[model samples]
Target: MSTAQALSPSSRAESLKKLEETELDVLVIGGGVVGAGSALDAATRGLKVGLVEARDFASGTSSRSSKLFHGGLRYLEQFNFALVFEALRERSLVLNSLCPHLAKPVPFIYPLEKLIDRPYVGLGIGVYDVMGAGRGVPSHHKHVGKKKTLESFPSGKRSAIRGSVKFYEGQVDDARHTMMLARTAAEYGALCVNSTRVIGFLREEGRVVGVKAVDLETGRAFEIRARQVINAAGVWTDEIQEMVGGRGQFQVRASKGVHLVVPRNRINSSTGIITRTEKSLLFVIPWGSHWIIGTTDTDWNLDLAHPAA
Candidate 1:
């Protein structure tokens, strides 16, 4: 077991000094979920690892997610069974074995509109439940009539609904979860430093060596030498790749998603609601005293760092 390490000012200074001085087995860029997870994985495996973040941890798309650990119910319609299965397994691991304290099972109701909607939606959710069985959450889904559906979601329109199928999904505060991941990686002997930006890649004879970085707080430039450099910059991934003359095998595009939060009383729902839109799925998720609704997807071609909502 690894001892807990505090992400304090002293720790940050020490980490920075060590990063400037030592050579690492793996150096991770970005402080999002993927980068933090990579650092944790490397450190736990007894590899010398270092993680750097441009801004605060989870300050980008990682924190701006829908925050549900669902098994992609819509993926079933696309016949993407492998992706769905993998997501369900990861969701189970997160809720049960990984971050049980940071995540929990939340019930959601998929409301039906037409009489014919029951069997179709029910079949889908039934398959979803079966696929996710014994993975952590409740293995079965419940079907409720209109009366019970309205009872559960009193704010729902009366004329549009027929019945509902209820299923379970995991919920989390994405920011805290990601921050904890970095801290845990640090505890496992990975040097984690946020507010540090990688300006360019350090290359030797056309092979990447490490990175040239700047500490945003002090504006001090430094170099971190490592055998391998992993870029997990999320939306800013392309920028990192470009620093190396854009030789990366893949390119990344950015999408902007917007969500609205309203007081819980405005919805009058005890459970979350999922509905179908013409283009995608709509969710009215229950969060504390408020409901998180919406999520408009659009192409983002402007700023990668500070995206306007």
Candidate 2:
């Protein structure tokens, strides 16, 4: 078992306090992708940074993502051009420049059922492919007839798919990637201590300055001073903001998305698939050993400490 899995929350907290008092330029709270990225950004920018996480890294929504680092294809339907384009750029950068070893390309097959659907879906997918072409990802997706589509995916009925468009996107092991990011930030001189809970904010002159945290393992408490504090606490962002008396500019709405994992061999497919959901999109992503499926987007009002499956 990893040390992360074995460490008591109290013990983790004590270590963090000892590390935090050792001097730092920036203190980042949370250890999800955004927080970890922030720490890395601060450290790389020549700031002495410290990062504390209340749980093992990526133990939140970051690890529970769809795992695709892609330009949102469905977002095009809503005319979310800016988001799509920006994501395409970031996807390429991550796959090629940032973390090639962790991010790799995967093909997805979009099945078209009707003749008219082909032109419409093809056009949108064509634009998507073109927008991302010449990036680190593949150039263009190919259109395959029903015969080829069925040949490619043995599990689907021959009559089920009129044709299929195969496109590519990037994938990553979210947990591993997140951990590596934290590790890399630490390597660059960021003090990263997991299992340290930020109990409250240190304030002065009606402004936030630092944080008072507890070592969940040893039950010890300490204070770390910083010029600015970033709350990348995701689902708990509001709670963290409340700790500092709730004076933030933005409010977060909670949504729940659930994914199911099944053996890859159970679903015979040459590539992954995407289908339109009533509220959003559903994907059958091909993980190395399993096929990750199901994502239901709905309002969430439950215990965030344990996300409902």
Who wins the TM-score comparison? Answer: 1
Off by over 4 Å in 1: 1-3
Q: What does candidate 2's lDDT look like per residue over 1-309, in tens digits?
A: 122222344544544654666656788899999999998889889998888899878999889999999899878888998899999999899999989988999988888878678888888889988788748867578888988888888888676679888889999989888888887787676778886899998888987778898877677888988887889898888899899885577777888888899999999998999877677778999988899997887788998867787
Q: Write the per-residue lDDT of candidate 1 for residues 259-301, one digit (tens) a residue.
A: 9999888878888999999998898888888889978889899
Q: lDDT: which candidate is best?
A: 1
Give every collision pair in model 2.
Answer: 9-216, 9-217, 10-216, 10-217, 10-218, 11-217, 11-218, 13-215, 14-215
All models, RMSD in angstroms? 1.2, 3.4
lDDT score, candidate 1: 0.90
TM-score for candidate 2, please give it.
0.93
Q: What pairs collide in candidate 1?
A: none
Candidate 2 minimal-lDDT segment of 10 residues: 1-10
